[model samples]
Target chain A: MSRIHHLPLHVEFGDCDPAGIVWFPNFFRWFDAGSRRFFVACGVPTWKELEKTTGIIGTPLVDTQARFVRPASYGDEIVVETSIPEWRTKSFVMKHRILRGEELLCECNEVRVFAQRTGADPHAIRAVPIPEDIRALCG
Target chain B: MSRIHHLPLHVEFGDCDPAGIVWFPNFFRWFDAGSRRFFVACGVPTWKELEKTTGIIGTPLVDTQARFVRPASYGDEIVVETSIPEWRTKSFVMKHRILRGEELLCECNEVRVFAQRTGADPHAIRAVPIPEDIRALCG
Candidate 1:
């Protein structure tokens, strides 16, 4: 069975645009929040833990494709489902779906690659192999 | 001269993930902000003005594709350039590029469709012709 996790999110006022509908970009923010929760649920060290213990870097999204099917409004309670579809040596793909009851609101797929911090520029990133613990959980 | 407007953005701490680099998702936020400013520069109503005056609904992104060539860091000042590539009868396409000085960071293209609001629901969206005023300025 696939490791599936459910996350509940409250639409914040900042998440909406002047139209009173949740801005499309905020969907991604919710997705990232759910992803963090999924990692915690799986016993993987949270981002903070990884930073302190392993020096492991947070994965950076290389590509993302999302489709907004139904509109979500401010103050709506939404559920987000996240699952890993594929795990490779250095990169992995995650799929997320946001729903309101039976209504599908948004679907997204993201590709993230592990990287190591190097050089004087902290943002200077280079692709590295996934850590063993992450691979075990995601694989 | 090409009708392009450049807006400089400071990458905020909230814009970065635990990776210590600017999160890819935040790029869209910057794009939206830059586009809003660009429209204002072109004499188009600010997003707030449009929402109130014409009941002009905000455009919903139907599709978007972004390519990350280089990582942008928190606190980095980046420039976003926005331009209308094509204005269809009811929808339009906008192109955005993020640059750090002379180095290109990322580029994205988005398709937005005019959606009309109906009683708090946006299903009443129909492709309304681009207003001549917007076309003249954007063209």
Candidate 2:
């Protein structure tokens, strides 16, 4: 099992929609934050530093599935638990669960790849092989 | 087959990440706007109006899957095409495709429910049966 990283957050009023609940897209934002925090917890360098040293930009999401189990409102305290349960040659699966106390509010599984800029264009990026050293550090 | 609605959008600078690519979560936000536009195109009243008469607040996503195909950036003009492929007793499937000119950028399928406030608490919501009239309008 990989290490699980927990990121605590406080829901702000702006995070809620007119329905007085957190907008669905904001959950994705939190998940992305949790992913980066997980890498930091694993002792991986920031994507900017990695780009300079390894020519690797960052992990970019290719596919994702999310399930919303409960509604969350502004002023609520939440925590995101993130882990990588599987890793492949160029892609990895990141799982994130958002909880309010003991209750699960949402969960997501994202497939992302380590990408490197292929050309001068910023959008020109391609998935690169997972760096073995980084993988070891994460493990 | 349901009526397909298209919503045009212009990508803004703030929508991009440090990588100069559209942040993935913004795609979900556009998909949601496309969903509401789809209903309006079908001649269904806005959720707020519906709530006044039918107690239906809106369609809230329960499950969603998204696949990112190509990267897009600021200044790009995109369109979101939305349609409903299936409807169930208390939930329906909404499909959204994002395209930049002829190239597809991202696609998503979301399972959503018609909800009604169960109590004074905003978080207290429960799925309700699919409204026959609204379904007919969308079809």
Candidate 3:
């Protein structure tokens, strides 16, 4: 069974909009944090460490979908539950659920691939095959 | 015919991740900007104005999907093209395409609804029917 990870977040005033609700993009930021937390919970190496050992820069999203069920405001303490449901040859699907106590605030599903820097362009990234060792760690 | 709007943005250094690429979540921030700009380009009143005149606070997204094609970094300037492709009784679909010159960086489709405050809860919002004048303006 794949291990699921949970990351708790404290929403600050900067995370809210003029409407006094959390800005939508901030959820994505938390989701990305959840992704990293999932890997960490699985005892995976940090992306920076992997760059030296495996040439893997990081996992970057190719596609993503999100649904907002309710609005949250500043000072809200939320938890993001993250898990990797499927692993492909070069990609994986990561899912996140943001919640406040028992209330689900938002949910997201993302398709992401392990990436490597291409050539000398520091910004250019190319997808690489899923490393077996990393998969074993996550599993 | 529906009007399309474009919002230009400069990528700041803080918007980049440790990898020096634009963090994926920042695209959603630009998309929200494009959504507001679309209504502005259609000559609709600002959300603050509508709150008093029409009881509409703003358009809040219910669902969203995005595809990231190319990565962008700090110092890059991008433009987001926004348009409404479909309008329902209580919701509409907002589309945004982020581009660097002719290169498409990311694209998003969002299902959003006009919302207003509910009851005594300041942060609670409920969807309202599509306003006729607003529809006419967008169309």
DockQ, every prediction: 0.56, 0.89, 0.80
- What DockQ was computed for model 3? 0.80
Which should have the higher TM-score, number 1 or number 3? Answer: 3
lDDT of 3 by residue, A1-139 (tens): 5678989899999998878889899999999999998998888899999999887888989999999999999888999999999999999999999999999999999999999988666567899999998999999
In model 1, the Cα lDDT at residue B6 comes to 96
Cα lDDT of model 3 overall? 0.91
Q: Put the candidates in DockQ order, highest first.
A: 2, 3, 1
**Which prediction has more favorable lDDT, 1 or 3?**
3
Fnat, 2 decimals, each candidate: 0.49, 0.89, 0.81
Candidate 3 lDDT, B1-139, residue by residue in tens = 5578889899999988877788899899899989988898889999999988877889988999999999998899899999999999999999999999999999999999999998656468899999999999999
Model 2 residue runs over 4 Å out of place are: none
What would the per-residue lDDT of candidate 2 be over residues B36-127, giving only the tens digit for each residue?
99999889998889989988888889999999998988999999999999999999999999999999999999999999998888899999
Which residue pairs of candidate 1 clash? none
lDDT of 1 by residue, B6-124 (tens): 99888888877667688776898888887777778888876567767666777777777676778988889999999888888877888899999999988888777766656656444
* Displacement of the residue A134 alpha carbon in candidate 1, Å: 1.5
Worst 10 residues of 2 chain A by lDDT: A114-123
Q: What does DockQ come to for candidate 1?
A: 0.56
lDDT of 3 at B18: 73
True-vs-predicted CA distance for residue B65, candidate 2, Å: 0.3
